[model samples]
Target: MSHSKHSSLSHDRHPLNFQDTYICPICRHGHIESLTLMDVFACDFCRHIFTANLKDQSIHVENSSQPMTWRWTGRNWQAANQLDVDLTVVIWLVSVSLVILPPSLIWLSSHAFPPLVGSSGSWFPAFWVGLTFTLHFLFVSWLMAEHYQFPLYVSTKVRLRRLLDRR
Candidate 1:
């Protein structure tokens, strides 16, 4: 069984985005049939068919509907991941510089040691501050990614078409 239905109730009536259009069952290609409330669309092209039940919003596609072509619109997740990683690295660098480096330099200057080679006592506070900032940034980034669906929205499109004879 397909995980998602090809139709969207939001786009009813228009031919391009018709919610209840009938398609051929054999070839998985759309047929010329105009769908009505009583009729289920059947693909004549590739042994696919589907219908929406009136009483309860149930979308039923027959066994033949298994092999129908599925299309989708969304960002490529792998590409998005690459971009996320880049962003993460940039953030990490910024955090190290702004949060970790400056304070360490100040604390080091207070003691008798090199600014870059951080003193022992200064290490503790620096570590804590860096850890806290990193954790906080990570959490904010995670929340933003979740809320925004991290890069893009993922959606699918399926249609039934007639299996025409090529010979």
Candidate 2:
């Protein structure tokens, strides 16, 4: 015959109960605490609300009562429905170029490549300036679309494709 002794810790542990020491899955900056409502937990630092499922031992942040469409990637929460783009450096370069390029071109054309006054060359400078301005505007528009993830209209995309195909 064998006798087994039950541990007090084992008796106190409930499968559905969450400890205050558990780190928040979303922020990782705060401890998770059980809310007044059942199976709900909240982060102290980030103030993010989560629902705890004890049966599966899973923590889920609610986008709604429905199943979540986002996932925590250890560092941040990402939309599972959206494709991620690695455009950090491209966005930064475009932003800096937008701020610096136009002014630099204007200054260079006015001072370094100034047109002769009261001559046919005067119209040349105006044309050059107009061309530079148009190019700058187009470049900025393209950069803005890329930065904001703007969807190109179908007709515009088809037109651009046709134009490119001609070359």
Candidate 3:
């Protein structure tokens, strides 16, 4: 009875078949299939096209006109030409500029022409000045990030962990 049950279970449909499914490097999905074009594979999950190199026996993912070659780093695929910039650095620089520029300008303007501005008795309070600076800083930072193609945030914890590893 045990042998019969085992045989029946083996014949049943399995979730994965090794021969048909290929693992996708981009999404880590296993539903990649070869397209009609020879040496080309497409991952529906990630919507990425992959080209198979026969000589090297490696898969290349198409990134625009240039194909970015990736290598399996034991566990994950890493692109050979990864040009990622640290967004934290950009944000830090922008924040520092915002903190310094507006206050300095306000001080300089008031000092340069004290009688005209100060005698008017219409100076903004500290809270309003700070609020205006904050709003302006946020808008400028967002615009700069969008214009320069910089991400607002990136997960660099993995890279930091790797660097901190002693062994």
Best by TM-score: 3
Query: Which regions of candidate 2 fall more than 4 Å away from where they truly are?
Result: 1-93, 96-103, 152-167
Could you give candidate 3's per-residue lDDT for residues 1-167 as a string of tens digits? Answer: 34432432344432322123355665553335677645576765555677765355456767434445655343334555454467657866877787678866776665665544455454554444567677877777665544432212111322345468755
Q: What is the lDDT ranking, best to worst?
A: 2, 3, 1
- In candidate 3, where is summed lDDT lowest over 10 consecutive residues? 149-158
Q: What tens-digit string does per-residue lDDT give for candidate 2 at 46-152?
A: 56577765555556767323233334333333444333455656766776777567766776767786767787767765566667667777777775654442224
After aligning candidate 1 to the native by TM-score, how far in Å is the CA of 13 from where it should be? 16
| Shift of residue 94 alpha carbon in model 2, Å | 3.1
- Give lDDT per model, in order: 0.39, 0.54, 0.53
> Least lDDT summed over 10 consecutive residues: which range in candidate 1?
72-81
Kindly indicate the candidate among 2 and 3 with the higher lDDT. Answer: 2
Please give, for residues 1-167, the per-residue lDDT of candidate 1 as tens digits: 12123342233332322243333323324441324654555543333454534343233445531322221112100111123668767766765565556556555654654335555564665565567667656665555444333212101123211123332
For model 2, state the Cα shift of residue 14 in Å.
Answer: 32
Give candidate 2's error at residue 44 in angstroms: 44
